[model samples]
Target: MRVLLTGGAGYIGSHTAVNLISDGNKVLLYDNLSNSDASVINGIAAITGVKPTLIKGDVLDEIGLVNAIEKFKPDAVIHFAGLKSVKESSLKPLEYYSTNVGGIVTLLRAMLKTGVNNVVFSSSATVYDSRQKMPVDENGIVGNAANPYGETKIICEKILADIWRRYSLNVTILRYFNPIGAHPSAMIGENPVYPNNLAPYITEVALGKREYLGVFGNDYPTVDGTGVRDYIHVCDLAEGHSLALKNMDGLKVYNLGTGKGSSVLEVLRAFCNVEERDIPYRIMPRREGDVAELVACCDKAKKELGFAPVYNLTDMARSCLAYARKNFSGKIK
Candidate 1:
């Protein structure tokens, strides 16, 4: 199969491209490089020995998407593009809406013009605002998220659902819980444009990029009193995308997560264990849109999409540590 991956140069998309190419599929990467690097293309080529065709353009541009579809004629499109920072989205709502929401409209329009019907989207776990639940499932009440970034995901899911219902498009929406870790090879992995997510922050602290890990909400209801979340490995998440593409019918949404919650203190402890160093920290107040705990029930994905997380916390920590140790030094950026 040939795939056109929007945001392909980004963390998950690039890793998925690696897996897809290894599986004897051709991949074309579509990215504007807003948050990812062009050097990643070289890294992918280094690892896989096959460079995915890349188009440098925004998803909002119709001409570029149409041209990409016509030239590539991909069997499916896996979209990983858009602004992802929860805090930033809260600050600049319109930019988030334009890039995240408007970008989808452009992709769909280009797909419609090019007669491409299959799509695999990168959705979010934020859709399920499960305050009382431990492991979030697809059937749970999808309460309105506390921020614009999550709301965009909710809105995109609805748009995809409506399109699938009306046009009979094959759409698979994968709701990602906190994705951490790197590739086992350490050749390619998560590279954030900004410091926002947990794993990266921990990585920075361990590398002395910052002074301490901010233990948000140390008074939560969890065993450790810190907020808990399901941190799935990036490879596992990449493999899940491959599983999603295997099916090309109707509408299916799956939760890609570890199914177990790890608190901020637990993450810090795990980093200490893995790196064999104490990470300095403080118990800061929880952010505005932050939650106390959220894991995932991935049984549906396991049963239907043949998806299951294979990497453990140790594996996750090791990979992330490897990447951070080599790439991020306190002196660099």
Candidate 2:
């Protein structure tokens, strides 16, 4: 099948392109190289042996999207382009909403004109309200986002839902847990603008980018007084996209996680074990809107999409360390 991947040159999108091409599907990647570099396309081509059709364009541009859809005529589309930084969203909520919310509308309009219906969206677990219990399922009540970034995601979901109400748009919304780890080949991984995520921060400490790590809070009432989260490998997350396309029959929501939650200190210890060096750290006060534990109930994904994470915590730590050490200069790890 021919597939169009928006933001396909970004971190997870690049990895997903590799998997899709490996599975013998034709892919055309549409990206603006805003947060992602164009060289990522070369990296993916090197690994997959088949470079996807590259279109330099913005999803918010109706003319550009129409041209891409007309040229590629993809059987399905996986939308991954948007402003993803939570803190940035707080500062520039309008920009986040414009890019995320407006981009979806533009794509949907273009798709309607071109008659391309299948879609796979990269939603987040942040869509779950703060009142959610420990393990969040697809049935958990949706609420207003704690941050602007999450709010944009919720807005996009609503847009997609509204489109589906009138027509049969086969869509699958995959709410990802915390994704970490580099590809085993060490060619591609996450490249955060500010590096706020836990894995990148840990990697920075190991690489001596900073003198010591700072814990957000240690009195969260978790197992070790730190926050707990479900960390899934990036490669496995990419694999889930392929399965999602197979199961995109209706408006289905699946949690892409391991169904196991690990604490902050536990991840630090795991990294220490992988790097063979003790990590120095200092605990700090909790930040605003920080939750104690965020885990996913992934039984639906496992049963329906046949999704199962093969990499363990040690694997994640090792790959993350390798990427951090190799590309600590802030050049697309």
Candidate 3:
């Protein structure tokens, strides 16, 4: 299978590309290199021993997308491009809507023009209403997004469902929970500029890039006061994409996660234990649009797609530390 990935040079996309390539699939990466580095292509090659063809293009560029699709002739496309910061999304709502929403519209139009139909969308667990019961499933109510970033994902999922109904497109929407950790080889992992997520912040403190970690919202109704999320290893999340590709029949939704929640302080302790040192931290107030808990009821995915997460929190922490100590030196672009 020839697969095309938007933002494929980014953290999750790169890991997914490695998994797909290892499974004997050809991959072509289409990315603008906005938030990701070009060196990720090298890392993928180092891991998989196959250098994927990369088109330095944007998802909103319809002509560029069509040209790449025609040239590469991919059997399917995995859309992984867009702005993905919750706090930044609240500050810049228009940009989030334009890029996240508009990019999918353009890609579908290009696919319609070129007769390429299958696509797997990268949605988020934030689409679920936070007030709902714990361990949300595919049948859980959606469209209760807390931030503009999640709102854009909800809109994109709706667009895909509509297209599937009218055009019979094969689409699979994977609502991912909190994805942390790095590849076992430490070649490719998350290295976000500005560090929006907790894993990268924890890694920075371990690497001494920052002074200390910030434990936000120690007053939430969680085991600890901090927020709880289903943190899945990136490798497992990548494998979920590979599984989704095989079962993209009609419009389907699946939550990709470990089916268990971990508090923020619990994750910090895991990292500290892995790094063998205490990382300083201070309690901070919760940011706007933050939720108390977001865990996944992944029984559907596990039963249907054979998606089983083998890594525990300790494994996630160890891989993250390995990636930070190996890849991040002075400054990451």
C-alpha TM-scores of all predictions: 0.97, 0.94, 0.98
lDDT of 1 by residue, 91-199 (tens): 9999998988898889999998999999999999888875756687888878678789989999999999998998889999999998888988888888878767888
lDDT scores of the candidates, listed in order: 0.88, 0.87, 0.94
lDDT of 3 at 109: 99
Per-residue lDDT over 113-154 for candidate 3, one digit per residue giving the tens place of the 0 to 100 score: 999889999999989999999999999989778999999999
Give the alpha carbon lDDT tens digit for every residue of 194-298 in model 2: 576788888888877777888989998789999898999999999999999987787888999998999999999999998888999999988665678889999
In angstroms, how far off is 328's CA in candidate 2?
A: 3.9
By TM-score, the candidates rank as: 3, 1, 2
**Candidate with the larger lDDT of 2 and 3:** 3
What is the overall TM-score of model 2 with all chains considered together?
A: 0.94
Give the lDDT of residue 205 in candidate 2: 82
Error of 2 at 169 (Å): 1.1
